[model samples]
Target chain A: MSAREEVLARLRAARDVGGSTVPDVPRDYHRTGVHAPGSAAAVERLTETLTDYRATVHRVGDLDGVPAAIAAVLAGSSSVVAPPGLPGEWLGEVTATVRRDDPPLSVADLDRLDAVVTGAAVAIADTGTFVLDALAPDQGRRAISLVPDHHVCVIRAADVVSSVPEALARLAPDGPLTFVSGPSATSDIELDRVEGVHGPRRLDVVLIVPPRA
Target chain B: MTTDLGMPTVASDPHGHLRGTEPFPVAAHRALADTQLRQNLGHATRTIRAKRAAVVGEVDDWEELRRAGECVKADVMARLPELLEQLEASVTARGGVVHWARDAEEANRIVVGLVRETGSDEVVKVKSMATQETGLNEALGAAGIAALETDLAELIVQLSDDKPSHFLVPAIHRNRSEIRDIFLREMPDVDPDLTDEPRRLAMAARAHLRRKFLSARVGISGVNFAVADTGTISVVESEGNGRMCLTLPDTLITVMGVEKVVPTWSDLEVFLQLLPRSSTGERMNPYTSSWSGVTPGDGPQTFHLVLLDNGRSNVLASPDGRQALHCIRCSACLNVCPVYERTGGHAYGSIYPGPIGAVLSPQLTGIDGPDDVNASLPYASSLCGACFDACPVRIDIPHLLVQQRAAAVEAHGRPTAQDLAMRAAAAAMASPGRFSLTERVVKLGRLLSRSGRIRSVPGPGAAAWFGARDMPEPPAETFREWWGRRERS
Candidate 1:
């Protein structure tokens, strides 16, 4: 028998001899956030949690507020990488020269850029995590955000969910996804968390909230 | 009907020198004397423990989540063969190749062959315990490939020519100054004025690794969770080195134990919540990169998943002991273990250490008939029950430790003095007559008492027990005698 067959055989024999019992999974845990889905409380909790993780949170009233928030976050940058299909108005007020990644920028090209701005697929309020599916129009290939030094992710209030399960429900499982919680950080050195290691050192989350009635 | 694959399905002892030659006690004794190691472990474990407790306390359904996680793993184990077949088909359909290895040697050979085919003399690596378990780096080096460890802690361990002492922080044993010295002495282009500050140290490593990440052709990693339904594999990490290696390389090879698979993408919902809070005490790790087999013009276009069984089947064979496979490699058990906090990771000898390692290593090596060091691992713990409490999956590590101890004792052909004493005590307690006779004999031991305590005794094991504690003097009357007098009255 090949190694595969032998291994499988052994597993089968073990299962037969031991007769392992599978238990029913109790999933009584909170699958949804305690706060109502897409409620103001959820967005507020997300903002606070993201801030706690050291990601600068900028609460914008709407899409119109996004450009100014982007500009403020990228105030010192000379050049920025914007993914293809990103709303043109989002970068309208920024003085930094916008570099479109329609053809996709090289690693060196991205490394030299000062910042990256993209939209998120969905955001989890409880865990303060944001998912970036490469197939999404605003969230380009994984490299665009990874190679740059700073990232400014735009999260609409509607896209913010209460928990990880809610966030997973919104994502397409087949696409490559990166769930980012904070700026690249490491507790590897003496188990002391020192933010900014290999990925973007600075993360600015622009929360686009809808106008209240 | 039987066909030989020219490889031993049941390896006599494939771990070799990796399972350190000395038993745990001797090694732990040497480790105990290192006050520096003890202090480093104490400080790190305490800090992580506090953070984990705070975050875990915030989750109201933490227990429910743990139970669900355990069930998912148990289901996976019960139907492992079918699930693996499903995983193989899904991955193959999505442009990934799957290879199976029965033991460590075959796993190493398969990995080395893949690197040779890539024709890359050097490979960048994420911090992977699977690779460490297989000793893949040593195998790759022998085949003329330099496997550069890219994770910050792994880099420290690699550069200093030391083994990883902790799971999350491999260099947890090294202080800031020691890390600085290692970087300065080993890193080729390090700054001359590098201080011992952690931020400066991180910056120096980032600069050093950037060049390698940009140019690497092949990257190697371990799987945190493999989604059998979607053919996706996820790696949870803090630093961006994992992202760099997983994305920049043209070819990627991942070595995953069969136990790492979960049934569906939705199952990740439970683990994603459990792992981060349990391991690093983060709401979520800094980065969790998940990719299905291969994506065009994005992450590695060529992907290979190596399914490793190196004694996992043996572990699955026992009904009472098989829950050991439920571990998520969170190292929560290690952080809370009283023994591990004192002796550190080296004393366990395997790349795996602490409470989980004590039960895991011996079974993974098949301790049924051996008097080797692996058998000694079953006795490495104090059975304090901290590891089980801290385990996110609730593996019941102390129960497994006791079970493995019984198996080890049964395997020993000759009974030791302690075993003889235990047998005699069991026999004496079997009946009221025997018990009363033994109690009468025990009253004679009052003669050896000095000032109401017996500090020493003549038995081989009694000396060691008496060294730290004193035995109390026997009571004047047996409990049975008192019960009979009361009944008469």
Candidate 2:
């Protein structure tokens, strides 16, 4: 018999001998946030959680506020890599030279850049996490957000969800996704958390909140 | 007893089973004397334990989540064969190729063959327990391929020529100064003024791994969770080394145990929540990258998934033992285990250590022989239930420990002095006549007592116990005799 056959047979025999039955899963955990979805409280909680993880959270009123927020966050950046299909006006007020990655930048090129400005597909408020799908225009490929030293992500208030289950519901399961909670960190040494290792050291989340009517 | 396809003994393949040369007690004794190791372990485990407790306490439905996680894993085990077939189909439908390995030798051969096909002599690696279990690095080295461990802790263990002592932090046994010395000696272009500060150590490792990540053609990793429905594989880590290895390489080979698979993508929500909080005490880790087979113009274009069944089926054979497969490799059990916190991971001898390892390694290797280190592992624990409480899936490790002990004793065939004592005690307790006679004879213990306690025991098997502890002297009168006197009055 082939190795595959042997393994399958062994598994079958084990299952038969064990005679175990699968039990129904109980999911009584909170699926929604304490604050209503897309509410002001939800945004505030996300900001607090993100800040706790050491990601600078910038609250902007709307799309018009994005350019100023981007400029303020990238004040010291000399050059920034912007993904293809990113709103050009988001970087309008920034003095840093904008490098468009329509053809995608090399890893070395990305490494040299000051920061990468992109948009997130969805954000989780409770855990303070953001998902980036490569197929999404503003998110670009996984390399842009990772290779640069700093990352300034633009997240709309509407995209923020309450919990992990709600966040998973919005993502494409088969697409390449990177769920980043904060700047790269490690607790490997002495169990002490030291931020910044291999990935972007600085993360700035720009919250694009809609102004109250 | 054997039929059709005669199973090859696990001993035939040297790397298939991992067991220490010395018994656990002998190894633990040496470990106990190492005050430095004890201090390091005490500090790390306490810090991690407190952090995990704080985060886990925040969740109101933590118990429910744990139960759900257990059920999901149990379902996977019950339907493992079908799920594996579905996973193979899903992965193959995408651009990935799936290979099956019955043991470590075949797994190593398949991985080496793939690397040879890529024409690459070096492979960058993410921190993978599966690779460690298979001793993949050693196998690759024997085949003339360099497998560079990219994770910081793993790099420390690799550079120092030491085995990993912890699951999350492989070099948890080493202090900061020790790491500094290892880097200065092993790292080629390390800074001369490197200090014992953790940030400096992390920076030195990052700089050392950068060159390899940028130029490597092939990368090797292990799967944290393989979604059978979407053919997607996820790697969760606090550092970005996993992302670098998973993305930059042209060819990627992942070795995953068959039990790592979940039924669907939605099932990840529970694990993604349970793992980080339980393992590193993070709401979510710094980075969690998931991808289906291969993506064009993006991550690795060539992907191979090696499904490993290295004694996992053997573990699944027993009803009580099958819960060992429910482990998520979180190391929560290790952090809370009293035995592990004292002896550390090395005393267990396998790459896997702690309470989970005590049950897992022995079952995986089978405790059928007298001299097997696995047989000794069943006795490594104090039967404390801390590991079960810390376990995200609630594996009932104490119950498994007792069960494995019984199996180990049976495998030994010859009864030791302790076993004889237990048997005699059982026989004496079986009959009322024997019990009363034994109770009447128990007054003789007063003759051996000094002051109010017996300082030493006479038996060879119990000398060690009594050497450190004192037993109280027997009462002047038996309970039955006292009751009779009361009745007479």
In candidate 2, position B420 carries an lDDT of 83
lDDT for each of the candidates? 0.88, 0.88
lDDT of 1 by residue, B1-489 (tens): 124433223332344524877888889999999999988888888989999999999899999999999889888888887888889988999899999988788899999999999989999999998888888888899999999999999999999989898888988888889899999999999999999999999999999999899889999999999999889999999999999999989999999988898999999999999999999988899999999888886889999999988878778787767788888899999989989899999998888898888888888776646467877887888888999888989899999999988878877878877688899999999998899899999999899899899888887788766865798998887788899999999
Which stretches in model 1 have alpha-carbon errors above 4 Å?
B1-18, B368-370, B450-452, B460-470, B476-489
Superposed by TM-score, candidate 2 places the C-alpha of residue B323 at a distance from the truth, in angstroms, of 0.4
| Candidate 1 chain A weakest ten by summed lDDT | A14-23
- Model 2, residue A120: distance off in Å is 0.7
Q: Which number leads on DockQ?
A: 2
The CAPRI quality class of candidate 1 comes to: medium
What clash pairs does model 1 have?
A: A1-B3
| lDDT (Cα, 0-100) at B298 in candidate 1 | 82
